[model samples]
Target: MKTVSIRNPGMSWDIAANILVPPGFDEGKRYPAVISNHPIGSCKEQTAGNVYGAALATAGFVVIVPDASFQGGSGGEPRWLEDPEQRVRDYRDVVDYAQSLPFVDPERIGMLGICGGGGYSIKATIIDKRIKALVSITGVNFGRLMREGFSNFDPLGALEGMAAQRTAENGGAKEDINIFVPGSVEEAKAAGIKDIDVLGATDYYRNRCPAEGAGTRMLVSHAAPAVAWDAFAFAETLLTQPLMVVFGDKPGGFGAYRDGMEIYGRAASKDKELVVIEGWSHYDLYDNAVPTGIALDRLVPFFKRHLSDMPAGSATNPAEANH
Candidate 1:
C-alpha cells in the first residue's frame, strides 16, 4: 500500500490518494483497477473505504482510495465545507490520474461510491465517461438530507432560506446558529429509534463509547442554507455502464438501497443490477462486521464480465504453440 497525491492544475490543489497492490503486483501482470470514493466528512483512512480497497487488492486488483476533497488527508481550508459540483470534478480528476498509471487497465476501471460517496458517484457518471462500472452502497443524497438536518428526512427546503440568509449577510447581520453533533435525544427519535438517555448532557454527548477526537465545528451549520442547490440526479441519466446497487435492510439503511434500486430501474443499459443485504446497516457495509464477506465479491465479476478480453492472449498456451 502506498499513499500519493495527484495535483490538479485548476484547483491549484493536491488530491491525496492511497494505492494498494497485493503480492506480485510488479510481476509483469497488469491488474484491473477500482477507484473507491469515501464518505463525506470522512477520509481515505475511514473503515468503510479502507476495507473496500483492501478487499479488492486481495482479489488481485489495484485499488486507489482517496480522501475526498476537503475531507481528511486531502487538502481544503476551513475543513468540511461541502461542495457538490467540485466533488464530481475531484472524482474525474482522480479517475484520470488512475488511468495514467503504468500498471492500470484503462478500460477496466470501476467506481465504488458509498453513502455520501454514492451520490457523488452517481453525479460523476453524468460527467465522467471513463468509469465502466459503478457500485453504490447504502447511498445518501447529502444535498437533500443535509438541507433540513442530519437525522430528519425532511424536504422542507434550504434554498430560499439560504438565499434570504445570504441577503442578510450582505445587509450586515450577525447571529450564531448551529446544529449540534449527533446523538441528541431528539435526533435519536428523529432517526426513528428509541433514545438512550445520556445524563448531564449540556453539549454534544453520545450514549455509546466515549466520543473522542470529534468536535463540533459549528460553522458547518450554514451547510444547509449555503448548499441549497440541486444535487446530481442518477435516475435522470440512466448510466449505460455496468451498475450495481447494494444496501442493508436495516433502519436508516432501507432508503439507501431503495433509492439505488429506483435509479437502477431507469438505467439505460441492460447491464445494471441491484442487490439488497437482508440484515446489514449503512455502517455494516462500511466494515463494522455483520459477516466476513466483502461488498466487493459482487464487484469482481461485475468488472471481469464487462471489461472485455485482455490486450493479447492469455488462454493460448505459449509453450505449446510450437507443437
Candidate 2:
C-alpha cells in the first residue's frame, strides 16, 4: 500500500491518495478497482473510506482513496464549503483518473461511499458508467433526511430557515453560520431533540472517524441548503449500473436501508442487492465495537463478488498464472 498524489485539472491541484496494489501489480495485468468516497468534509484517511478500501485491496481489487474536492488535501476555493454538485463532480473525476491507470481495467471500476458521500456516490453513478457496481455505507440521503427526518413522513421544519438562508445567499439577509452540521440550538430547541450543542454534535461526529478522531475534516457554515436536493426521482433509467447497498440495522441506519431498498428495488438494472446489518447502528458501520478489519470484511466480499470479471484462482498476474 503506497500513498500517492495526483494533480487535478486546470490548476495543478493535488488530490492525495492511498493506493493498495497487489504484490505483483507492476507485472502489468489490468485489474478491477474501487474508488472509495470518504465522509463529507473529511479526508481519505477517515475511518469509513480508507479502511473499507484496504479491506477491498486485500480482497484482490486495486483500491484508490482520493481526498474529496474541497476539504483536506484536495483543492477547492472558499475552503470547507460543502457543495453537493462539486462533490458529485469529484466522484466522477476520480473515476476518470482510475480508468486511466495502466493496471486498471477501464470498464471494471466501482465505487463505495461512506455517510454523506454515499449520497454523492449514488449521484455520481447517474453520470459515470465506468462505475460497474456501487456500495453505500450508513447511506445518507441528505435531501431525504433533512426534509423527512428519520421517518419519511416527518420533514425537518426547514422551510423558513432555508428560505432565510436563500435570502442571505442572495444578500436578502445575513448568513446564519450555525446550521452547518445540523442540530443547532435553535433547530434543536425547535425540534426539541436532546444534546443539541456543538460539543454534543461533535462527539457523535468524532466517533465516526476511522483513525481515532485523527482523520476527519469539516467546517461550520450554511454552505448549502442541501435539504432541497434529492438524488432520488432524478430519473429511473439513468442509473443502469449494478448496485449493492448496505447499512446498519438500528434506528439511525433505518432510513438509509429504507432508501437503499427502495432505490435498488426500483433501479432499472437487474443487478442490485441491499444488505441490512442486524442490530447495528449507523455509526457501527463507521467503526465502533468491531475493528476496522471486521467492519470492512462485511463490505469487501460484496465488491469482490460484483466488481471483478476475472476468475478467482486464475493466474491473475502475467506469467505466474499462465504457467
Candidate 3:
C-alpha cells in the first residue's frame, strides 16, 4: 500500500489515504474498488488498511483506506473534532477520489466502515448513490451513543460542560479534551470497572495495536454536534443500496450490536443481510484474528457479488482465489 493525498474541496484540505491494489494490478483494466474507513480515534493503518484493506485487495479488488479529516494524517484544524457531518462528507470525498482513478470502476465502488465509520458510511450511502454496496462491522451510531451515554453518563450534563469548555476556549483557555479510553485493564480491574467495551478498547488501543497519530482523544466540544447527529436519519427511504451489517453477539457500552440490528431492520435495501458472529465482543472484531477471519469470509464475497462483474479469467469465488 502506498500513501496518497486527496483534496477535500468542501473542507479545502487534503485527506491522507493509503491505496492498496491487487497483485498484478494493471491500469489498463478497470477494477472494482472499496473504500475502507477506520473507527473514530484511529488511523488508516490500524484495522481499516492493515487488516480489511489488505485482505480486500488480495481478494481481487482495489481498496483505499483514508484517515478522516481532522485526525490521523488528514488535514484539518482543532484536531480530534468528531463532527459527524464532516465524517460523512469524508466518505463522499473519498468516493470522489476513487471515481477519479483511471483503474477504478466508478459504478462498482463499495464501502467498508468499521465502528464509527460504519455509522458515517450508512449516512453517506443514504445520499451518495455512487456507493453500490456497504459492509458495516460493529457499527456504532455516535449520536445515539452520546445522547444515551454509557456507564450512566449524563448527556445533558456533558453538553453543559462542553458549552462551558467552548466558552473558555474562546476566552483563550487551553482546549479541553476527553480521553477515549481512560485506563488500562489492570487499572479498570482494580477500580472494579466491568464494561466489556471499555476493557476491550483499552487493551486494543493501548496494548494490541497502538499507532502514531491514533491516540484515544477527542475535543470535548465535539459532543455538541455528535449528540445531535444520527447516522441513520432516513434509512427507510434513502438507503437502497446492497447492505451487509456484521456484529458480534456480545453486548457492550458502545452499542454497536444494537446499531447493527437497528440498521439491518431499518434499511430499505432488499439485498441486505445481518451477520452475527457468536461469542465475540464488539472490540473482538477489530483485530482479533479468529473473528476478523470470519468477517472477511463474508465480506470478500459480499463485495465481489455486489460491486461489479469480475474480470474474464479471475476466480469466481474469493476463497478459491490465491492471494
Candidate 4:
C-alpha cells in the first residue's frame, strides 16, 4: 500500500488516500478496483485502510481508501466540517482518480463503505453509475438519524442550536466544534449515556484503536447540511447497481440496523443481498475478528462475482483464490 493525494476537481481540494494494490501487482495488467470509505470523523488509516483496505488488496483488488475532504489529511478550509454533499462527491472524485491509473479497470470498479461512509457510498452510487457494485456495512443514514432523535435526544433542537451557532460564526464569533462521542466510557457512564452505539464508539475511538488525524469531533454548523441530506433518497429508482447491505442484529441508537433493512427493501438492484449477523452490534463490524471475517467472506465473493471479467464463480486471480 502507498499513500497518494487525489485532487477533487470539482471542489479544488486534495484528498489524502492510501492505494493498496493486490499482491504481486502487475502494472501491465488492468485489475478490478474498490474504493473503501471511512466512517465519519475517521480517516483512511482506521477501519477503511488498516482493516478492509488491507483485506481487499489481499483478496485481489486495487483498493483506494480516502479520507473525507475537510477532515484528516485532506485539504479544505473550515476543518472538521462534515458536509454530507461534499462527502458524497468525494467518492466521485476518487473514482475519477482511480480511472486515471493505468493498472485499474474503470469498468469493474466497486465500492465498500463502513458506518456513515456506507450512507455516503449509497448516495454516491445512485448518481454515479461508474460504481458498478456496492457493499454497505453497518450503514447509517445520517439524515434519517438526525430527523429522528437518537436515545430521545432532540435533533430538531440541535438543528436550531446549530443554526444560531452558524449565525454567530458568521458574525466573527469563534467556531463551535462538538465532540462526536464521549471522551471515555467512564465519562459516558457518569453522564448516564446508555446508548450502546455511543458507548461502543467512545471505546473504539478512544481506547481500542486511536489513529492520528482521527477523532470524535465535528463542527457544530455541520447540522445545517447533514440534517437535510438523505443518503438513501431515490435509492428505489436510481440504485440499480449490485448491492450488499450487511448489518448486525443488535439495534443501536444510531439506526444503522434500521437503515440497512430499509435500504435492502427499497433498493432497485435485482442483484442484492442482505447479510444479518446475529448478536453483533454496529461497532463490532468495524474491526472485530469474527464479525469482520463474516462480512469479508460475503464481500470478497460478491465483488469477485460482480467486478471480475471471468465467470461469476470462477477465480479471476490466482493470488485472490489463496486468500
lDDT of 3 by residue, 129-199 (tens): 97889999999998898888631478778788889989999999999888888568898778887999989
Q: How high is each candidate's TM-score?
A: 0.76, 0.75, 0.94, 0.93
- Alpha-carbon runs more than 4 Å astray in model 3: 150-153, 310-323
Tell me model 1's lDDT, rounded to 2 decimals: 0.62
Which 10-residue span in candidate 4 carries the lowest summed lDDT? 313-322
The C-alpha lDDT values of all candidates are 0.62, 0.64, 0.88, 0.88
TM-score order of candidates, top first: 3, 4, 1, 2
Q: Which ten-residue region of model 3 has the weakest summed lDDT?
A: 313-322
Backbone clashes for every candidate come to 0, 3, 0, 0
Q: In candidate 4, list every pair of residues with a backbone clash.
A: none
Residue range 1-323, candidate 1, lDDT tens digits: 88899886587668888898866778365567888887654567654345777777777678888776665567765455567667778888888887677677666677888777787887787567778788887666666656544434443444445556656756886533443435565665576654221111212134322222222233333455325544345555546777887776664522565466666676665677777777655655665545226456676677667653435223233232113
* Candidate 3 lDDT (Cα, 0 to 1): 0.88
